[model samples]
Target: MTYHRITSIDDRYFKPFHQLLQTIFPPEEVLEYELWREPIQDPAIYVYAALDGEEVVGATEYRYYKELRVAMTDFTIIGKASMGIGRFLMRNREQHLEQIMKDSGTVSLGMFAEIYDPYRAGIHSFGGVSPMNPIVRREVLSHMGYKRLELTYVHPSWDHEGAAVSELDLCFLPQNEELSELPALLIVSFLTGYYEALPNKPEAWHAMIEQLKTKETVKLAPL
Candidate 1:
């Protein structure tokens, strides 16, 4: 198996990438081709694909927020059950993130993952079929030294009244040469603060962040 960073969403890769995603996630969860294609065009988004020969097996998508010094990782999907594909993709993605940060003059890069809480019932739940369970994904992330910091919710659509809030677990992995400069707690605080300032319904984000701040962060095991 080989891994590659996809700079462009060409048909050569997207066709298989879409297929792999469809195979893993349900129809409701899958983003339309145009929707997925548009974001990848942004220079800030990093897309990586794992290939077994010419066939795509797994992929990961992450967006770097320069102001926040955070790499917001969206999804890490492994097409089929395998021992190390997920880890390989994650490690490679991290390396790519480091390179991007170095180029962008970003130090103390923080890796963040917004995990949809599978246990949460109702419209807020992130229910979908996948080759690996969400709990397993959390285990892998934990093994990689990411800490669960807070629980929050995001409106998946623009509709405020009817839209269902998606329950999210905000996880962070601090990668910095000066560990004292950017602690895990501080990183989480910065992210929540950033969200709280969003123009759309800033009050709601502030409320969520405030609630999250009151909750104790989950202790992480040593890597």
Candidate 2:
């Protein structure tokens, strides 16, 4: 199996990969297929897949904010680790992002991910026989060295008509081991731009950003 980066929406595996995400995640968690089309051409956005003989088995997506020098791990779906593809794709993705930084002569502060709060998120069946347990997912990510940020995180609405999603935790994998804390303003800035780029946002989005403004620092804790 090989890892493939989808730089164009025309890639044959692009649609299939989106279909796979729809199968595994609920509507709120997965972006619409058409939404993937525009970002595919943006240098800041990245989408990749693990393929076995042209058949996509797993995929990951992320974005880099050049000004912030940070990357966000938006979505990833790698099945059971027993298959080893999960680890492979993850390591490759990190390396790819590092390469991007190197080519640009810039260094990333860290990579961020938003994970469901296991206790609060409950179980998501996604029409599958086996439901997804956030607890298990958290454990898996914890083993990979992702540390949860200590903050009241509420996901902004994905679109104008959507409501804010709660029970989510922001996780970070820092570029430097000695780095332990980040200024609250960094997160506030990133989130402000994040929401503004969306089609529309609700009051909760504004409230969350306002709350972040009152914090001096955002600390990280073991997941």
Candidate 3:
């Protein structure tokens, strides 16, 4: 019923996020838990999380695209909105991802997933029905001032021809400890855009965080 931000120190939840991904996603996609929980010795990669109470329900684990100068939402937003908790959790995740942006000076964040937000409203409205449960990715690119190019490649799957699989299989790795009420599925929906319909792809889709540079273009247009 509450939102919690998963920090590096919060070992209790971080492990689960890793374990969960390992079980569901292909080993190739799952990164080491320690590498993600610890600070980026690389100066670019940063790890973050969102929790329900003390339970880590959602997470962002990826290397900041430094050379390319963009941060990609790697994977790990997992929570349930059945009780309306996912939305609140998203606010925290966005804020965290934004705070990390100060260093790179780039808004172009990239991510991979399989589906879209079934509950998303605003500039990110998607109309197509998702065969998968629907996962959404976050790319911090638009803050750089490009919405169209900002969303050029927002679907998951480096290999579109690959098969689909349950993200849960990735989440249940032995190292992951199950949190009480955290809905990892719904939380994943907002970040990675993966659904159940496709079961062998291992991974599915991706997205970027979109924003508009609204300036005072009109002075007397308020009539």
lDDT of 3 by residue, 42-77 (tens): 344455555566665555555443344333444544
Cα deviation of 110, candidate 3, in Å: 6.4
Indicate which candidate wins on lDDT.
2
Regions of model 2 farther than 4 Å from truth: 79-81, 126-133
lDDT for residue 30 in candidate 1, whole number 0-100: 59
Worst 10 residues of 3 by lDDT: 214-223
- RMSD (Å) of each candidate, 1 decimal: 5.3, 2.3, 15.0
Better of 1 and 3 by TM-score: 1
Which residue ranges in model 1 land beyond 4 Å of their true spot? 7-9, 26-28, 121-131, 155-162, 176-223
User: What's the lDDT of the predicted structure labeled candidate 2?
Assistant: 0.77
Q: For each candidate, what is the lDDT?
A: 0.62, 0.77, 0.37
Of 2 and 3, the candidate ahead on TM-score is: 2
lDDT measured at residue 134 in model 2 versus the true structure, 0 to 100: 65
**Per-residue lDDT tens digits of candidate 1, residues 1-223?**
7776666557588878878777665454456676655656767667778888898888888777777777777678877665477778877877877787788898745677766556762232122434356666667776766766534555332222323345556667768422323343555556554443223444555566566556554343232
The prediction achieving the highest TM-score against the true structure is: 2
